[model samples]
Target: MNVSKLKKGVLLAAGLGTRLVPYSKEMPKEMLPIFEGLKGRVFLKPIIQKIYEQLYDAGVREFCFIVGRGKRAIEDHFTPDWAFVEYLERNGKEEYSSLLREFYSKVESSYIAWVNQPVPRGTAHAVYMAKTFVGDDFFFAAAADNVFIGENVPQKLAELHEKRSTPILAVKRVNDPRKYGIIIGREIEDRIYEVEGIVEKPKTPISNLANTSLYVFPPEIFKAIEETKPSVRGEIEITDSIQILLSREIKFLAYESQADWVDTGTWETFFRAIALSLKHSGGHNIVFDVLEALREK
Candidate 1:
């Protein structure tokens, strides 16, 4: 199968996010602020937007956003605001207006369709909801909570998928394997795992390579998901389905990313992501400048 033919990407953002409650009580977890500036202004962008931008850069022109009932904000953010954009232009903000217009133009070009995940099902169920949209081909999948940052991680993943013509799962080496889905396998090369098995949250993990919620799946995955039964937790596990596929001699390649994996599902990881983003945004220096100004006061 030619992976170049696979052009669709699915973003899973329908989780209830019970872990980040109080904060997530009003806003979707995907909308959480991962960065802020010292100017008292927040430089926050939805997780989905960042993932979408990466996919767009990877030649993925179509997207299916799997959202739940309270995820209207996700849809609204992607929707074009032509009227407001024109208003900005009329008020002598042509630069800002043009930027927004260009953004809307890209949104229009990108075929973005929203699929509802009414129930708080597992990742497999959320992905299965987009099967009809995927048709008979391979597609990309990324969790909204995990942001992959690099020069061209998405494009590189797409290139690998096209070369191998198989499902490619993104992974990162972590010191603590028990906290994530650990991928156990022989290292064929540096940072490349053959993926003999994937153990989700294992007490005694065999490897430190944790699955980072990025995947390139073929259409057969939909069948595997259909055959999958709900686990003891009453949620259909995507890993179980992928294991079934692996048992059938299907190839699951593990591609390691050099970029940092920021998991924003918890308070600690969320703050870490904010700090990293701030450092990248030149806001760290701004913080010191603000501190100096306050001391001079």
Candidate 2:
């Protein structure tokens, strides 16, 4: 068995976020805060930061972030602030500072590159922007707005890739397949499928396995993206690109993840993500208490 290890990651954060409205008007959706806890204290961290840290924990040392207009905040947040850490330490807040310190150490030890996507061409285009950075390496291509709260899905995907040595797509069973890209595949094993076809937001659903925007892609993905034409929405969809690869006999595997897949794209999902994160952080009781107190007010 040929074992492969992944050390490169590409994060796509270049969406217009028209659905998020005012919250995303000035802030990138990827920069939206998610609840986190350490040492019995709750902390708010950006979703993209969480994604990066999770991937880092999975042994990915090189990162390429694709950003669009007004997405400079994502880049800025990734830049460590020593003065803030020092100020926290000065105020006897070692816990908060320690978090920053650890995060900064990870950033300092890793290679992070930013690529500008001037136009909102689509997901495939955003991924294509990292072609030069990734360069023939099997890397994790993830959407910054989405994350798996309780499990390190990237590490699991890497492990599966190591065993199979094929392109992998993270999928989840959804009740409403019309809102997501659906996958049609032959089940090879438990929670594993040989992906035969994938379609974006199909009118007539074929499968409930929705694409989760987490992928372990090979270098051929870039070529597939190049050959992919625009979708009905006039944007290059990553599903279409994968379908192109499928046509050429590029085998892909669909891994149906059981982890809590949180997508902070729309208002409903964003609120749900916050709730899930709070629950994961063991802070839901505190939130419930506050809500009850507010109810008395």
Candidate 3:
């Protein structure tokens, strides 16, 4: 089974990100700076870009970005800037020019289309907006706020999806499963869990494996979403749709990520994610040196 043959993807980035408050007031939380350079050119790639790059690496060529009304910034970032490229070339910054050109080329090739979700809807609603684009096939879905950091989790999941011929949900075992959508399953192997049931934010969780907001879904999921009812909060929950699919005897599998999963919705988590990213960037030693220099100054 060649998973690379399936070539479509979806990214959910329509949330208001109210938890980040003042910082999110001006910019999308997904666009928050995770790291900065001494030259003032911040390495502030959004969560969307990280997910996009991962999917791109996993052989997903067409991307459907489900965006809200105020997410023009995201669209703009991926848009080609011919004028900027020309300016860089005129100034003899050939390296910078080439880099931007390469980035835009990837965007042009992979960005199939964009779907607008006009209202501040829930995850299910955002996903439903991509139904037209998804058509009738299995596609990859990832939340913009959650980043999967393994060397090849995306590639591994893609391969697993093709081999198993089923929907795959990335799950991780946490001490407090009540804070997430928990999955009850038979442990097939060290990190592989054969899911029997899924409960969203259960009061008394049956299992410690919680949904990590990354999934490869079959087209039938759209139908499940349609049949799903809104929760007490008047929001269409994706978890409800998953439950419906499970009731229909759909085969759902859970795979644990080898790398860390970070949720940057809150300030604490956001800072932690930033620190983790910095450490991964191989600049932690430099950071310590800078701190020492500051102390001496």
Q: Decide which is better by lDDT, 2 or 3.
A: 2
Clashing pairs in 3: none
Candidate order (lDDT): 2, 1, 3
User: What global local distance difference test value does model 1 have?
Assistant: 0.82
- Model 3 agreement with the true structure over 82-164: per-residue lDDT tens digits: 89999999999976787678678888887568888878657888888989888998988888888865455678789887777
Question: Cα-based RMSD of the predictions, in order?
Answer: 3.3, 1.8, 3.0
Off by over 4 Å in 3: 1-3, 35-44, 89-98
Error of 2 at 74 (Å): 1.1
Candidate achieving the largest lDDT: 2
- Model 2 TM-score, all chains together: 0.97
Backbone steric clashes in candidate 3, count: 0
Name the better of 2 and 3 by TM-score.
Answer: 2
252 Cα displacement, candidate 2 (Å) = 0.6
Q: How far is candidate 1 from the true structure (C-alpha RMSD, Å)?
A: 3.3
